[model samples]
Target: MADDLSPEFCAVLRDAFERAGYDADGVLRLLGDSAHAALGRGEPEPARRAARDSGALGSLIRLFLLGDTLPEREVRAILPWPESVSTGVVRVDGDDVRAGLDVRPYGDDQGSWWVFADLDSDLLGGQVPADHVLGVGHASLSLARATIRRPVGSVLDLGTGCGVQALHASRHAQRITATDLSPRALSLARATFSINGLDVETRQGTWFEPMAGRRFDQVVCNPPFVVGPSRVDYTYRDSGLAGDDASALVVAALPEYLARGGVGQLLASWLHLPGRDWDERVTAWLPGGVDAWFVQRDVADPDLYVGTWLRDAGIDPRSPEGSARASAWLDWFAENKVAGVGFGFVTIRRTDSEPRIVCEDLRHAFDDPLGPEAAGWLDRIDWLRAHSSPDALLRAHLRVADSVVLEEVSASGDEGWEAVVRRLHRTDGPGWQHEIDELVRALLAGCSGALPLGDLLELLAAAHGVATDALVVAALPLVDELVRHGMLVPA
Candidate 1:
C-alpha cells in the first residue's frame, strides 16, 4: 500500500474529483434548493436522501459531507484503495468503509479548493474534541471577507486553524506563514495546502510565539478570541486566558511584528465590562503610532453571549447538559462582572505619527469582502491626517462623492414648515449616513473641485455675514470627518 503524497497522486485525485463533478456548485446542484437549505441549518438527512442516487457524486457526498459508512467496493472506485488504506484516511470494517478525516469543497469568488478538518458537530453528533480543527465557519468567512487582498511580499496567518485564512492569503501574498498551537491542527493545515498544491510555511506555536522578532507586510488572524471561563472543550474557539485576554494579547503584540505601512486585520470579541466604555476598553489594547479602526458589529448581553457559545460547541441549549453549562457560564460571568460581549472586526495600520483611533458602532448588515472598503478607509485617514490644519484643508480642492445623497427631515410648524435635520446617505459600500447642518450641506452640494475650499468658505461667509476665519474653523472639522468616512473626496 502506498501512503506517501506526490504530485502525481494529487493530480490524479484532482482529475478524478473533477470528472465526478465534486465541487461547491456541483454539490448544490445535486442537492437541490430544499435539501441545500436543510444542510445549512445543520440537518443533513435531506441532503443524504437527495444525493443517495447520484452515483460517484453520491458516494463522494456520503463519504465527506455526511460522514457515513460506505461499501468498500464503492469507496475504492472513488479513492485509490491501497493509498487510502495505507494513509488511514479510510478503513475496512466488515466490507464497509469509514473515514477518519472529513474532506469538503470550499470556494470563494477567486476559485475552489478542498478543505480538510475534523468532522463537524452535526456529523459527529457530540462535543468536538479539544484539539478539533474547525473547517469553514462564520468566523473564518468573516475574516476572509474582511482581509485586504492587496498583493504583498509576505503575510502571516496567526492561529491558522485548518489554514483557511492562509489559503485565502495565498491568492494575494507571495509567501504565507501559518502558525497554530495544536500540532494536529498544523498537520491538517499542511495537508490542506498539499491537496491544493499550494505552498505555505507551517509553524507550531501559540499566537506569535514562533515568529520571534519577525514581521510581515500583512497579518490576518481569527484567533481564539471567544470570551470564556475556560478552554475546556475546543482549542479552536476558546483561549484558556481570562475574558478577552487572548484578543488583548494579539492587539498588544501586533505593533512589534508589523512592518511600516503594514496592515493587520483580525476578528475578535471583547468584554463590555460594567462602568467601562466599550471603546475605551478596546482602544487601550492598541500601542502607539498605529492607526486603528474598530467596527463593532454586534453586542449581546452576558446570558445570550454564554448561551450562544455553548450552542456553538454542540451543546443543545434546551437539553439538561446545556442548562448546567449555561448556568456555569453565567455564574462565571457574574463573578467576573462582565456586562456584555461585543463582536467585531479590528483593522490596524502601522504608521509613524501618533495613532488615530476611531471606534464606531455599526450594527446594520453590509456587503462582504470588505477589504477594498477597509483599504479606502486607511487611505482616507492618511489624507485627513495630512490635512488636519484648517489652512491646509481649505487650500485643497474637494468634490462631493457621487454615492452621497442629501436627505432632510422636516416637520410642519406654526411657521408653515421647519427643517429638523439634514443628512447625507451613502448609496453604496457599507452605506454610512451622516447628519449635516444647512451650511455644510450647502458647501458640499456646491463643491465642484474647481474652486479651493478656502475660496468657497469665504464666499459663503460673505453671503451669510459670518467671519471667514470662523466659517473655515467651523466647517473644516465636519468636512474632515466626511472625507475620512468617504462621504467627500479630494479632487
Candidate 2:
C-alpha cells in the first residue's frame, strides 16, 4: 500500500518473524499461502498456515517479495533486519512486503565457490525449481565490491541471479536493468525486488544478447565462470567458453558494452599456462582503454582444483560418480595450456588514459565490506584515469572522511579503533597501507615526499629498529589503507 519500501518496516517484519518461532521453511510456507494468487503459476504453499491473524504484514511481505514497492515509512517501521540484511540500494518498484527473520534460511554465501538459490526467481523459462537457479559466488561479489561507486546514473546487472548485485546497486543508481539467462532466475530476482520493493528493469538473455547495443553508466556481473565446460548449463556451473575461458572471453569483450566512463566489475577464473605468468593471463582478458584492479586470490594443484570445482556443482567430491568427471576437468586444464587454475576478482573502468593493471591476492577478512569498498574502487579508477601513472606529484591534499573509517566499538568505551588508508603501489610502485604502527610511521614519514617507501622503512629500522622483512610485509596492508582513504597519492 505504501509508495516506497522503508527499512523500518522491513525491520518490523524481521522482528515479528523472530518471535514467531517459525523456521525458514515454515515461514516460507505461510508466505506461499498468503501470496499464492500473485505467484501466477501453481505456487506451492510453504506451510499449512493454520492462522486467523494473517494481516497487513503477511500480505505486505508476500507482495513485497513477489515484487512490489511500498512506502519508506512502512519499510523502516517493520524493523528486524541487521546491517548485513539491512537496506542498501534497492528501492520499491511496486508494493513493499516484509520478510523478517525467516529470510536468512533462504540465503547464504559461498567463499570462493558454492551453490546459490533464490526461490523468488523462475528458472528454465519459469518451470525450473528455485533450487535449480544457483546464485553467484563470493568471487563475483568480491569484484563487484571492489569497483562500484556512488552517483552512477543507471546500471545494468548482467546475469542477475536473484538480482544480487542488481539489488545492491539499486541503492545508488537512479535506474537499473537486471538480466539473466534463465527466466527462473529472473523470476526470482523480480520476487526479491518485489519483496524488498526495489524497482529494476528485468530481462532475459545470454551475456548481452537481450540488451544488445545497450549501454549503462555502470555494469556488474557474477557470470557462470566455473571451469570445465558443461553440457547442462543449469543454475550453477559453466565455463561457458572453453578451458574456463568463458569468463575471460566475457572480460575480453566487456568494453563493447561499457559506457565511455563506465565501470565493470566481476569475479573470474583463468588457466595458468606452463610458461605464462598468471598475471599476464588475466591481463589479457582486459580490453583496451580500461583501468583494472585484478586480484588472483587463490590457486590450486590440478587434481585439487578439479575436485574442488566438481564439488561446487552439488556433486560429491569423493564419490565414485564424480571421479571420472572431476578427472576430466583436470585433464581439460592440463590439455589446454593450463598449468594451475587461478581464481579471483577484477574491477575495470573504461578510461582514455593508459590502463592501470593491479594484480594481488587478498584473502583477508573483509567484514561486511560490500558497499563502500566498491565505491572507493570507482573513485580510484577516476583518479587514475584522470592523472596517468608516472604521476609526477600526487598533489592532492586530503581529509580522511568519516565513512572512510571502519570501527569495532567496545562496550566499555575504552576500546581502540583502527584507522586505515591505502596508498597503492608504494611498495615497488603498488600503494601501501597505514594499517599498523610500522607502516603508519613509514607512511607518515613519506608525507615529506623525499624518501621512497623502502628508504623510509630503513630509516624506521635504524631509528626505532624493527626487522626489515617484518616491516615490509606488514606495510602492504597499511599502505593499502592509505590509498583507499585518499590520504596518500602516487607522486
Candidate 3:
C-alpha cells in the first residue's frame, strides 16, 4: 500500500500549493507562451529554461512536471520534505532531490483536484514502463468531458487509474466504487482520494469482477481500448485481447450492471472491418433493452494508427524494433480483415425493454464540458423514441435550440446563383450539423412554445403553396432527426 500522508500534512501540502499558485493557469503564467506550448508537445526543455530563475512555484513545477532536482533546503521550505520522502513520493540524490511521482492539478469550472501518477516521457526523457500508471491523459480528459454529471445514488469507475474519474464522480454520487487491476494504481488512487478529502471504495479487480451482483446508477471507463497485436499487456494500454474485444466486452456487459435508467459512458476504439457496416457491428454488441448514442470522432488507417500508438509508447517508428512491431500490427489487421480503427465516445442508458440506437460520425471540434449536452441528448432520445408516431409528434410543442444557428451555401451557375445547401448546426457536442430543405428551415425558425407542431407545418405548407399533409409527411422525419440530435428541443 502507498503510505498516506497524515491529515495534518495533507492540509499543509494543500496550503503550500495554494500559496505557491501551483495550478494549470499558474503554471501557464510562469512558463509563458513558448515554454507552455512546448511543454504541451512533450518537450520540457523550453519550460525548464523558463523556470530556471523561478521561485517557490517554479521549484514545485520542476520537481513534479519536469522531474528536476532541487536543493534540500528549497524543497523543505515549499513542502514537508520528510513526509514526502517517507511516503516514497520523492528521493534524495546527493545535494539535490527528485520526485518519484508526478502530481498535478486537474479540474473544470467547478473546482480543482490533484492527480498523482507515474512520471511521463518528458520527465524520464525516454519511453515509459509498460505498467506505468497514466496521469490525466487525453483519453482520461475526454472521458471526464463526456461523462453525465447529474446527481446519482451510486457510481462505478472501472479501470480507475489514479482515481481521476472517481474524484469527478465524488462531486455528485453519494457512493463511489473505483476498481483497478493493478495494485500500484490502486495505491496511488487511494492516496489521491485521501489527499482530496474524498471517500471512495477502492477495489482491486479487472472490469466488473469485484462488483459482481452489484448495480450502479452510473459507470465510467476509459479502458485499455488501444487496438494492437501485442500478446502481452501494458495494463494501461494493451488489454491482451485480440482486436477490439476488450471494448466490445465492456459494452456487452453493461446491461447486467446498470440499473433502470442508469447510464454507462466510455471512451473506446473499435475496428472497422472491410466488408461490414461499422454501426451495425458496434450496435450488435449492445445488450437488449438499452438506449445508446455513439459519436465516432476519428478514424485512422492501419499505418497511421500503428504509428500514432507507437509514438505514444515512445517508440521510434524508424527504428528496427518499431519496424517489426508496425509490420506485425499491420499483418494482424490484414488477417482480421480490418479496414480502419474508429475512436469515439459512447453513452448507453438502460431505458426500455426494446433497444434504441443512434449512431453518427461527428469528426469535428466540440464544446467543453460535454456532460450536460450528453445528458440532454439522452433525454431527447428518450422523448423522440417515445413520440415515434406522426400524430404524437404533431401534438407536441417544439423550438430550435438556443445554441443553434443556420448556415447557407451557394454556387454560381452558368446564368445565375444556385443554392447548394442549407444546414442547422448546434454549437455543442461534436458541433453536430444537418442539412435541411427550405420548408424545414422555415418551420424550425418559426417554432414557438405555444404553437403545436402540426399548426406550424400547416402554416408552412400554406405559405409555400404545398398540401398540408404532404408537407407534414416530408418534414416529420427531418424534425425527428433534428430533435434526436439536439438541434431542436421540446418547448
How do the residues 1-491 of candidate 2 rate in per-residue lDDT, one tens digit apiece? 12122434444444454554333344445655454444334343432132223544443344233333345455444444343134322333344433321132233232111112433232211323323555444554565555455778889888887666776676679999999887656755665565555678888877888888887788888877766655444554463466667777778877777888787877787777788787887887776888777767677677887666555555665777677777776667666756777787777778887776777665544444444555565576556445433221133332233233322222333455443433322232112233334346434645555555566666676676678667666654454446554555554
Candidate 3, 1-491: lDDT as tens digits: 15465556666677888889887778888999999899878798999988887988898888898888889888888887688887667778887888878888777677778877887766666778877888989888888888999999999999999888998898999999999998888988887787688888989987889999999999999888988674754688888888888889899997789998999999888899867878988898887888888888899998899998888777889999889989998999999888999999899999765667888887877666677878988888779777888999999999888989988998999978877899888876667788887777788878867799999988888999999999888888888888877888899
lDDT by residue (tens digit), candidate 1, 1-491: 11244446556667777889888888888999999889878788999999897999888988888888999989889886576666556667899887766778888877888876877776678877788889889889988888788899999999998889998998999999999998878877877788888989988987798999999999998998888786546888888997899899998898788999999999988998878999999999988989999989899998788777777778898899999888888888999888889998999999997678999887888774577778999989988888877778888999989888988889999997788989898887778889888788778866889999999998899888899888887888788788877888998
Native-vs-model 2 lDDT? 0.56
User: Which scores better on lDDT, 2 or 3?
Assistant: 3
Residue 398 error for model 3, in Å? Answer: 1.9
Worst lDDT window (10 residues) for model 1?
1-10
lDDT of 3 at 42: 74
**Pairs that clash in candidate 3:** none
Q: For each candidate in the order shown, give its overall lDDT on alpha carbons.
A: 0.84, 0.56, 0.85
Clashes of each: 0, 83, 0
Tell me the lDDT of model 3 at 445: 76
Per-model TM-score versus the true fold: 0.93, 0.60, 0.92
RMSD of 3: 2.4
